[model samples]
Target: MRAMARALPSLLLRLLLTSTPGALGTNPGLVARITDKGLEYVAREGSVVLQRELLRITLPDFTGDFKIKPFGRGHFEFHSLSIHSCELRGSALTPLPGQGLSLTISDSFIRVQGEWKVRKAFVLLSPAADSKTRIQARLHGSFDVQVKGITISVNLVLGREPSGRPTVTAPGCSSHIRDVEVDISGDLGWLLNLFHNKIESRFRRVLESKICEMLQNSVTSDLQPYLQTLPVKTKIDSFAGIDYSLMEAPRATAQMLDVMFKGEIFNRDHYSPVSFLAPVMSLPEQYNRMVYFAISDYVFNTASMVYHEAGFLNFSITDDMVPPGSNIRLTTKSFRPFVPRLARLYPNMNLELQGAMASAPFLNFSPGNLSLTPLMEIEAFVLLPSSAKEPVFQLVVATNISAMLTFNTSKITGFLKPGKIQVELKESKVGVFNVELLEALLNYYILNTLYPKVNGKLAEGFPLPLLKDIRLYDPVLEIHKDFLFLGTNLQYVRA
Candidate 1:
């Protein structure tokens, strides 16, 4: 039994290692959830579109011939059929499992008015003479049409295009017209009333058919093209660009829609994938907000890697870069107390600190906390009387920083505060000196100099991938293990 148990453990390990990629293995850097509230918001916007488009419907002009019992045959023609007004009473959008979205519109009404013309033929017979036919005068007037209790149902199939953009298509669309009332008035209004059944039936069929046709056209032509215009790849700066491409078709459920994105950063001039893959990330089950956005640490790390590879992490700090009115200055005279050799070798000369990141910075997220670690090397130099620089010493600085992240409508910003700092002298041309003596000076320089510059740049923040004319409102951000969660509602503003 013991031998069999050992063999089973080995088999299980092999199975786990060879498992196919599934929900637990798929790691998307960015995820977005649109809840029922978001669907309702979209439905409200769709109501306006539905109303406008329905009002633009033009029912086909209808012509028919009717027989008057024992009198004659009359022909009528209705033309210039146009909708005068429309009112939408209710609308809703719902998600379907394994399909897409369902849009339902109910209790809508429209008023249509048109012009009509009728021609009647009357026969008169006398016993003494042959039967004679008399043609009555042509009658023309206006008619009013009222179509109420209108309902429209459409299915929007969400998909992805070849270029990684989202697509919307209404493959199945149908409309229900509950009631259509037609009123005819003219100099022979009573005659037109005799054929009311035919007129009303024709009107109902035309309205129902035209309404669905207009809706299908609007979805395919307007909504689909608009979705294709989404910015999938946007430049973050001159050096790097961010990829917000959809990974696959969105997953639709009864309550929400889930979309995954390849939130990777690449070099703008020369595109290359980051070395690491994104870790699996999941969002909370709460749906209090209209929408929720989840971002993984891989997104930020890729950005760091891109910028570092572009050589942007190297910088030179001079005395002038120091904050104004600060006691700490980047001069050999100021460093004399910490390093006596620096003062003796380069006396009264201005100092410069050239720093380069040893590697890309790393960001870690835990529950309610975010931490950043960066390792860099700094070389001290003194400006000679002839404007040349002489190396004094080199030190490697490692820092742990805690960041407080905040987001606005367009961007995510962070404020990094230093937590623990470590410094070591890597090389010394002046002479060997106690590194501990320079700790306080380095701390002051970092706090008053390096941090301020970094914080200033961070305050500018990075842009978020959002659609045009859409903004987040009432947003709340939370930090989770290996990811960040943002819950908010959306607002559409016309530009």
Candidate 2:
């Protein structure tokens, strides 16, 4: 599982770098939104408090037999010992992706200044108490437990329980315990004073062990299961999967950590020849809080392929669809008023219109406009009343369309808006037949109905690939010769 976890990000990165932009857009860029959630820390003043909270280090009351050759034997029971005040210096944390975290914590000193009472204790070879009698005892001591240089390192790896939730596993924990000085003052004080060196040596070892144990337990209990799955949930409405991968290790600077990534959209149905050979660039440090994207033309081309495969580009204009009072006036020498009626007299006088791209659609991104131009073949066919099935009038019109793009943000998605559509005809069969009839119907349907229908379809904008709970801000967009740049601030959407 750990090896698989390590390899998943690499696989995702390959997909992102290899896939070319298809029907989704000309360019599909990665969405790297980093937040200070899993790996976090406090500094200086607040860190000490955080450390204290994480490891209270409250030792239970222990009663046991204390024996030494020179000091003799005694039954001793000690009261609870706890750390009261501490000086926290600083802390740092680095995340290990799916594994866990590496933590480094510092503290100037931890003052374990608490009262400890030992009762029913007696020492052999001592003048104050008899050897056979387990005399009742009372002792109070103040100990200054100090760590030299006060640097602690811990590595917490994550493991799962039976319930599938994540739990922390402390693989390594190291803390240096420099000195423990005990000032003994109480009944039978001479016995303690005599064995003080041995007592301090034993206490230091125990304290070090307790500190490590307490930290492991505390951190494991406090760690949350937030790094389970990193998903890019958004995609074009028609696209099925995400193509994204980490470009390199996360780059940490003074103020923020930047995760450099690359992504592209893919279409299983549409094959694209474009290649993304550009090297993954370093993250720019200009914006502290930003998401930067660069979209290529392959994404847009793939989306066109998907639309064509789905038969969305094919449309029809029937007799009933023409406005009630509208007329198709032919401009030939024998032009007649009833020609429009005669055109509609067939079982269904309709133009079987089909639009197809002559070449891939070109998407140009600018400050406000996202324009698309697809060289197209718009064919119109009219069926005669006398003909069985085939149309008597067949004409192919070559044209191109331009439109402005708009977009809106939803709870979990952002999609494009296609509006302000304009169609420009490049070539048409005008003088061959009654071209006026075909032209009138094309204008009436293409502008009045087809454009609106296309707009309606476009209102369901392409969903930008992103993660859930993320909110993208207004983007600062820029266009270059080969790519488009989009940068925005991002955050978790507030409930």
Candidate 3:
């Protein structure tokens, strides 16, 4: 008994997951939950700033091989025998190709103070340092430079390999640098300053090539691996689980990044066959960041199939269900109990109620009348004392179900209500007596037992997928021709 109790949830879970028409094989369903067709991830300026890592660079030593003779007095050859480098402190960046960015560096300077030699022609140099000859050359200044022509792009892919994670790939890109200017105050400012324009131009070309290379390498090599793997499954106790899968890679635009994915809220042990209807992405820009998803009939049908196979459609009315003051009616024609009450007259009689889905649920997403209808088969049987396992009397009824959808805050909620009820007497069997009033009892059982259960399960709608360190708010739903849209704003909070 204890072992059965422990295994009950697992059994229920296994039944909840079956197979769809297209997905009937092993490990069928997609592994990720897709919201708004996929993950419509938009990292604004704030997110970019918070996540940007620091950068550092080291330059090789420079050698001055040429000689400089000012006013034909004496010849001076300056040489740098040590290493020199500069650091780019911080940067402000924008998206898209051919955009502009600004970089600033404090305490930035280049110094090449070393030995110098001066040779005179007939010793006619006016200012000659023959006793002690030294070369003092230094150019130190803070820089506020602008870079342009930068282009960035990312391609996101999802799968389950070493782990269930999405991967991003970025190709190598380049840009041109212009408007390079630097201030200088050093000993060689007078003679060395002659080539200021030439120096700036050379630096611009080197800086542009270096920055582009760094950006491409970092995005493709470092950032790609970090974003490739993500935890996409949610655990709902030991019986149920919610899964998410990416339908395709994410595409980037001028303003935002768009991702496509699909999601499932079903049992852990059972699999439901589902067809993905890709939704159009028109992420409304009413908030800083938002996501939208369109719920389709496929999702509803998949949920229903999983529920049907989980044994939730079948129920029983035991002998203990008799009212305290009144006995259960033995005859189905009217509410008339047999003489001497049911315990003595029909001691071993019990009622068995069973329900099955005749067809998949139909979802119509019209303007105001977004309704879901499903057809089902319901059966009732009376177990006599002689036939302990089999039924003596049975009745089959067909029921038409209608459920209305409404919004409960960010989640979509549904209300279950039974519609037309059709009694199928051909498939129904009657033995000892015929009860005309059994139809009403069957209808009551369906509305109170089956339909409400379905509705309540649906009312516990799928929650919105969330990002790390971000709070989502005001999730809104919109219905379109191909798919449904779920939009919500994102707010970043400090942890």
Candidate 4:
């Protein structure tokens, strides 16, 4: 056995990981007890946040429900028992402070089912809306509950706000996200009513708001000012969801985003781009729902895809002069280097990623939950040479791509000689190269400014960058996804 261990490669060693307490694939359901306990449910449903942990959860009953074990029948449910990252984070016993809670999770699964109900109780929220306040959360919720092996199902309820209050509630909140409602007892002005207060220092709140506000300003001032009117011109746009309303200002929101260049940039004149409909769908249905309902802070009413820069990628271009319109397939078999973009969207608190990110400004604070690897995306664009007669090149869409690629020809009208291709992104620390990094790097190629001398001409061959060039961009081999997005300037090269 010892000699066999000696022959093992480092990859196996990493997979071995630190010896956790449990046996290999132990059923968490085995740890359940008959005592009361505190439970915090952090679940997302499409886009709503639900925070109400019910009573009990035990695998003693229920059919088709897979319990904490896979090899076994693995079917169970619980209440007043919230589970986080598999193990119990914390819980609030209803009516009475409960004791031990049931915590079960399957690492391979994306959703957890639950059944639950609540008795009489009142949850008073003292939202510290002071300018210096921020809101933090400690919750307990249950998807379902059980009493003596029977499922006690309950419908999620949302009571009407008092008639006098102007509740600005938007639809589509993420389900798994638990939003805390703050009820201020005193009268306050509009400006002062903007935020909730946490126990953190006063300066902390100011800093966060100030930073987000400053970012808002920087977008408007810097990136948007220089964009010209037509390769279909418009200077102002958004990046990383930050609005940069530069030049002859367009409306502030997507509802108002009129395609002014419509009938003009047609058919062959269009800049055909195959982009990702990439939904940040991995988020727990609860959190996804919570983001939809309760998380205005995480999203915005004026959300627009003004622009998104992805990279700081270090993936080496193995072959020089990759043929144009040719897809560089990175399958788990051919290219084990590719990472998935799913995990980068709804990052969990843990999970260290390694690879590259174009920009990773706030990654240190919170790593998003979007994590998946061995995935594929389709992002292709063309740079039309600036001649009265447009160039017609055959685009052979490559097969064997890892993921689905959707194209809406209307959104990206034809591209004429673009002066400079501006890609704004941040760098990743390799937390999950899995993809967000590669996705970021691809920006340098997709509709990017072709070699200025290449002068917006679509190169006839593949445009893969030399592997060495990838390294110079401050590649991150280990880090999270949120902070990855960097700014890049790439001139088209026909290599």
Candidate 5:
């Protein structure tokens, strides 16, 4: 169209001259231009509005095409036309702006914004038909479009914006269901042998299951607010992110026979929330584990959970696995009785209930039960500074533990055991934990048995047969503590 209108100020001046930040945080200025209202995009079988008949392809030959109509005024006309762009040079493309990509366009639709590394720069439409030989690969991105807001950076590595949350096991799970269904058995070769074979060969090599479920429902709507900060009672009904980005369709034999993945993990406030919320459980492999697109090896994770419990429930694949590649193991099944009339009808006076019961197996990489939410004011002190003569006894305590960053922080540091005072926690600038090792963790937690508990009145360390009573095993009665922790949500919080 007049060469896309004189290449719209040379692609918004190459997105204002490649935007910047390029050290690693990689922003590269993502530039744009060619507005007048155009480019509305969408994938997975719907939405399209292009221009200049171009959405083409590149490399050994994957073939391509995308052209739209309606232009001038309200505006329209989009294209990506690629017959072959010299094998996508650097790889990954998107609505990268400041350097080039803001895309808003409307008629049909177009939104896909930026940042978080433009997530493989959107545009992953693969039906598969070009491979005379050309896989050296290198695409890089910035094929953006935005109308009202004015951004049109489109050179066409061809795109950006695209992007798994799977783990649902509720003892009985009751409320919260808007409509979700996924039931499958063995297809993508049994999910390429159950999430193996390098994550089902990188989810069919990214491209087309409606453009990887529209980038796994846009990374399951951006990780449902960090899975709503976990811990309520574990019933998270749904949460998605599965953009199998085309899934390398060389031939395509079978994939959706009800292979699960319907989608609905709503906005729960909680009643018993133990949500590993399953929707197709692939949340972009927790951020690009090659966008994990394992199409079908095993998809049947039925969950309804809500107390009335059991135990030994662990699925598989989160890493740490070694030998020949662990294809899902440890299957036990639990949670069946815990409706104490819904825990006495919602008894959450700032909740704590997890003191003791008998249910403790959970170990696959531990880190649970722990809790804390101190992004900035965490001071765990116990100073004894005054050492000149004696009476120096001080202790400082704090707790706001917003509940160990969403379920299982190494078993919540194993129930926060780091307190025991008598003296020398390394000479006390702030007695640094391990003073009598909190008396051997208070004899295995209030006397369950790590031994020890004598003459301080059935309590306080040193009992287990009085270690030959060498004057109560002297060495200057040592003890101390210093754990100034103010940690919260283990990383990332710009807002």
Candidate 6:
């Protein structure tokens, strides 16, 4: 089973990067849509990143000396200045249609704390005494700085890297600081307050300058690098891996954003192309859900082809595999009534059936249902007392299997229901017998034995092709004319 978890940050980065001008505008096998409602969710998540990066901003230390001719001379230094906490009041992420995305953060607050030390010398020259008197004072204390009404705006431009990977660059970023307050707490703290105007002005200038720098670094250094590190191909299991390469650049509208993926499955060891091509898939214009994914029949067909080529669609059945207390048995006695030659030729001998799929199964999607058709060849042999076996007959079976698709938070599962079964005689060792009679026996075997085993495996559904750390919520799966539409909101959890 595969696990379906997508990192929200990766999705946003892809969308932002691919939404550049001059998109390919080709139809995709898989289409992922982010609606306006989803933008709100993204903004909330983005604010968390902004706050964390803002706390990492490094401000230069303040060191200088000042002279007051009549009063005295003073030297002060503020060191170890750092942001201790941050609070984001509001944030918005807006789509720019043909351009890229705009991120705005307003009215945020940051608290900074550091140590300040000052030394002052007061001198007086008396004319009568003709001697100079000097008084020196030194003060060291901790200062708290609060910056409020901090606004940051970033314009993300979309472009492609030399390697054809999507890239996001911040061409414009600006910041403003509305207020800065400083408080000194220590011995002679009141005297330090005398220079509060200068201290506040210096704090405001440093913060305003570094805010935009931090925002740009968050995109180019942090987000873009993470995006580049995401794998274009992900392994589903040992047998196969899924290709999530983009079919074309993404398209953005006033209401939503769309990203197209190749959505093909390939063999792990030997890659082979499927006979059929991917049909065009289109998502419905529904904005109620935060995200929507449209998966074409090509995805399932390619998987079927891969598994079939790997010899996974073969099985062997013997008498031991039959259910207990059943009238049916894989011995000559079971078929003696229909073919007397079986009993006369191999009396009381056991029987074994080996089945292999004739070709890769094909899946079809209709208005409300999904069905699979598989053709198989089964050979039956009679076991000899000397540990030898004699071929009794070979039969070809064709079946139509329908399933009701359902999904939980992580995976999509199905409950298969048998539809129609057809059987024909290919070869026979025993005297000619009615093929209809054999079909009846085989039908009973399938309904009573084979389906139970097959459905048991089907219940353990494969994981969806979502990235890590994301889970679907309130997922609704709908079958369309050649594809499946999954609409759901997503929850991102940090690992």
TM-score of each: 0.88, 0.56, 0.59, 0.14, 0.17, 0.80
What is the per-residue lDDT of model 6 for residues 1-495, given as tens digits with 9 covering 90 to 100?
123246666767778768863333344557778787777787888799889888888889987776655546788888899999999878987777877678888999999999988888878789999999897888899999989999988887655454434567898888888999999988856766887888888888889889888888888887687556434576766778877666655567788777677777789898876666787665677888988888888877787788778877677778887767656678898878877898899999999988888988878899898998889899988999999878888999998998777888866666778866888888888976766655655677777666776566457655565555677898878899898998999887876
Candidate 3, residues 220-266, lDDT tens digits: the string is 66645545433367664355555555444443445434343455556
lDDT of 5 by residue, 326-444 (tens): 33211111000222222233232111101111222121211223322211111112112332222112222122322111112111111322223222222323223333322232223
| Best candidate (score: lDDT) | 1
lDDT of each: 0.84, 0.51, 0.45, 0.22, 0.21, 0.78
User: Which residue segments of model 5 deviate by more than 4 Å?
Assistant: 1-86, 92-417, 421-442, 446-495
For candidate 2, the per-residue lDDT at 35 reads: 30
Q: Which ten residues in a row have the lowest lDDT in candidate 6?
A: 20-29
- lDDT score, residue 425, model 6? 82
Summarize candidate 2's per-residue lDDT along 240-275 as a digit string, tens digits: 333444444444434444443334445545545434
- Candidate with maximal TM-score: 1
Residue 301: error of model 4 in Å?
16
RMSD of each: 4.0, 10.3, 12.5, 31.8, 30.8, 9.5
Give the higher-TM-score candidate: 1 or 5: 1
Total backbone collisions for each predicted model: 0, 21, 25, 164, 130, 3
TM-score of 4: 0.14
Looking at candidate 3, the ten consecutive residues that score lowest on lDDT are: 97-106
Any runs in candidate 3 off by more than 4 Å, and if so which? Answer: 1-43, 54-167, 185-194, 221-291, 319-348, 356-368, 375-387, 397-400, 404-452, 463-476, 480-483, 487-495
Look at candidate 6 and tell me the lDDT of residue 201.
88
Tell me how far the alpha carbon of residue 372 in candidate 2 is from the true structure, in angstroms, after superposition: 1.4
How far in Å is the alpha carbon of 414 misplaced in model 1?
2.1
Better of 1 and 3 by TM-score: 1
